[model samples]
Target: MKLSDFKEGALGGVPIALGYLSVSFAYGIMAAGGGIDPLSAVLISMTNLTSAGQLAGTQLIIDGATYFQIAVTTLVINLRYMLMSLSLSQRIDPKMSTGERLLVSYGITDEIFAVAYQREKAPNTPYMLGLISLPYVGWTLGTLLGATAGNILPERLCSALGIAIYGMFVAIVIPQCRKSHPCLVVVAVAAALSCLLKYVPVLSSVPTGWAIIICTVAASVLGAVLYPEEVDEV
Candidate 1:
C-alpha cells in the first residue's frame, strides 16, 4: 500500500483507461439511442463496469422486458466475473483486509484483472485502488460525453460511432486469435453460432440473452475439449 506502488499501478492503468474511454463512448451512444437519458446512461456506466451486460440490459429495457428476464439475463452474462473474482482472490496481497478486498472487487473488469494478475507479486490495497481509479473515471466520463453527444449530434453521426464498439472488440480479439489456435477456434465457433442465431428460421426467434449464453457455453466447452493443456513434467 505504499505511495510508490500506488503510483506505479496508476501508470500501468493509463492504456486501459484510454481503451475504456473509447469503448464506453460507444456504450453511451447506444444507451442514448435506446432512449435512456444522458444522466441515467452515465449512472449505468458508473455502476456497471461491464460493456456486454450494460448493452444487453439497455436493449432489454427498451424492449420492455420483465424484471425477471432482465435479472436472469444480466446474471448469466456476468457469471464469468464470479470466476474472475475467485482467481483474483488468490493473487491479492494476503494483508489486504476484508473491507479492502470488498472495495477492490467492485472494479474487477477483464482489463483490470489482466493487469493485476501480471504483477510479479501479489497486489496490495493501494495498488488495486489506484489501478481501478483512472479507468473508472475514464469510463464514466466517456459515457457522459457520448450520451451528451448523442443528444447534440445528428442521427447519421451517432449511427457511425455505434460501430466503434465492434471495432474495439475486434482489436482486442484479433491479436489473441493470431497467437493461439484455441482462441481462434473459439472465436470462430462463437461467431458462427451468433450468425446462425441471427439468420436461422427457428433459431432466429430465440432471445438475445439466451443466444449469448448458449454461444459462450458451447464455445468454451468446445475449446476445452479440443485443446486440453499439456502437463509439465517434474
Candidate 2:
C-alpha cells in the first residue's frame, strides 16, 4: 500500500466518483419511491457497487418479484464483471495472491475497469483500493441524499439525472468504437440485438437477463467471425 500508488489511484477515480454521484442519486430516489427506506437503499449501493444491477433489482423488489427472479436478473446483468475481472487478471501482477485478487475484484466496475486498463503500470492492491474508495463513498452518499431528499426534486429533473449512467456508458464506448473496427462492429451487433429483444414480439417475451446474455455472446461471436484476425490481435 504505497502512498504514491494509492494517491495516483484515488486521483484516477475522481471522474468516476463524480459520475457515480448522479447515477446513485437517481437510484436512491427510485428506491425511495419504490418503498425501500433510505438505510436499505444506501445499503444496497454500498454492498453492490453497481448501477444497472441495483436499478433492476430495486425495480424487481418494487414489483414484488420472487427472490429467484431478483437473483437471476441481477446475476445476468452483472455476469460481465466476471469477464472484466478476467481481462484485468492479464494486466495485473501475476503474483497477486488469491485474497488480494478477491479484494481487488470487489472494485471491478465498468468505469473502474476502463481507468485501470489504461494505466501504464500493473495495478496493485493498494492502488485498486484507492481507486475504488471514493467512488464507493460517492455512491453511498448519493443514495443517502436521494433517499432522504429526492422527493423535493422535480420529476423532470430526477428523470434527467437518471440518465447520467447511460451517458457515462456512452462516454466509455464511443472512443473504443472509433479506435477499432471490430469493437465498433461488436457494439453495433449488441445494440441491434438488444433493440430487437426489446421490440420484437417473439423476442420480447424473453427475460431481460437472458436477452442481455444472448446479445453479449452473439455480438462477440459475430464480430470474431467477421474479423478473426482483428479479434486475435486484441
Candidate 3:
C-alpha cells in the first residue's frame, strides 16, 4: 500500500498492462465475432486471465464442445502456471499462509513470473500484491471496454495496435537473447519450428492448442539442457 511499493508495481506492470490491453482488445473483437455477449467476454478475461486458455475455451464453446473437452483444454493450456507458481513459491516468504499463496496465484502470468524471478531483493508482500492487482484490473477493464466499444473504432487502428502485443513479446525475448547464445538459439529454433508448423502441409492443421504445448515443452527442455543455471548464481 505504500506509495513506493505501488510505484514499483506500476513500473513493473506498465509494459504488461499495455501488452495485455492490446491482446485483450483483440480477444474482445474475436468474442464478438463468435457471437458471445460483451459481458461474457469480460467475465472470461477476469476469471480465466490466461489469454491462450480463454481463446481456446471460447473456441470450444463456439464449437459446442463437450464439458470434458473444455475442461481438458483449459487444463492443458494453463498447466504451465503450475510450474510458474512452484517457481514463485521459493521466492515468497515461507511464513506466508496457504490462503495468501492461493490468492496470489490468481494473478500469476508469464510477465509477472519473469519479474518475480529477477528480483534481487525479497519482495515486500504489499508490492508483490500490487504487482498483480493493477495489471489484473487493466486486463479485465480493457477487454470490457473494447467489447462495449466494438468496431466503432477504425479497423486499421485495431489491427496495428494488435502488433503491439507481439512487439511486447519480442521485447522480452530480445533481452534474454542478448544475455546468452543459448537463449537466442532456443528462440530461433522455436520460431523456425513454428514456421514449419504454419507452412507445412500435414502439420498445418495442428490446432493452436497443441502448437503451444509443443513449442513450450520443447523450448523449456532445450533451454535447460543448453543453459543450465549456475548454483552460485543464487
Candidate 4:
C-alpha cells in the first residue's frame, strides 16, 4: 500500500488503460445507437467493467428483452470472471482483509487479471487499486465520448473501432501461444470449438454467451488435465 507501489502499478496500467479506451469506445457507440443515453452507457462501464457482458446486455435491451434475459446473458458471458478471481486468490496475499478482497474483486477485468498474474509477485492493495484505476476511468470516459458522438461518427468508423477490442485479446494471447505448448493447444482448441459451435448446424442454435462459456471451460479443463504441472505463464 505504499505510495511507490501504487505509483508503479499506475504506471504499469497505462498500456491497459490505453487499450480499454478503444474497446469501450465501441461499446459506447453500440449502446447509444441502440437507444441508451450517453450517461447510462458511461455508468454501465463504471459499474460493470466488462466489455463482453456489457455488449451482450445492451443488445438484449435493444431487443426488448426481459430483465431476466439480460441478467442471464451477462452472467453467462461473464462467468469466466468467477474462475479468474478464484485463480487470482492463490496469488494475492492471504492476509488481505475481506473488504480489500471485495474491492479487488470489483476491479478484476480480463486484462487487469492477466497483467496482475504476470507480475513476479502478488500486488498489494494500493498497487492493485492503482492498477485498476486508470483503466476504469479510461473505460468510462471512452464510453462517455463514444455515446455522445455516436450519431456524429460515420458507421464505418464505428465498426472499425469495434474490431480494436479483438486486437487487444490477440496481443495478450499471441506471446503466450508462442512461448508455451499448453497455451497454444488450449487456444487452438478453444478457437476450434468456437468455430464449430458457430458453424455446425446442430450447435449453431446455442447462445453466443453460452457457447463462449462452454468453449472456455472445455479448453481450460483439457489444458489442466494434459499439463497439470505447467503453471500459467500469462
Worst 10 residues of 3 by lDDT: 225-234
lDDT of 2 at 106: 88
Q: Which candidate gets the maximum lDDT versus the true structure?
A: 2
lDDT of 2 at 135: 94
Model 1 bad stretches (over 4 Å): 154-156, 230-234
Q: Which of the two candidates, 2 or 4, achieves a greater lDDT against the reference?
A: 2
lDDT of 1 by residue, 47-95 (tens): 8988778888888888788888788888877887887788888888988
Residues 8-68 of candidate 3: C-alpha lDDT, one tens digit per residue: 8668887778778777887787777678889999999999887778877987787677777
Can you give the lDDT of residue 182 in candidate 4?
A: 92
TM-score of 2: 0.82
Q: Stretches of candidate 4 above 4 Å error?
A: 63-80, 93-95, 117-122, 200-202, 221-234
* Cα TM-score per model: 0.89, 0.82, 0.75, 0.78
Count of backbone collisions in candidate 1: 0
Q: List the residue pairs that clash in candidate 4.
A: none
Error of 2 at 157 (Å): 1.1
Model 3, runs deviating above 4 Å = 1-19, 52-80, 114-121, 222-234
lDDT of prediction 2: 0.86
Q: Comparing candidate 2 with candidate 4, which one achieves the higher TM-score?
A: 2
Candidate 4's error at 189, in angstroms?
3.7
Give the poorly placed runs of model 2, Cα more than 4 Å off.
201-203, 232-234
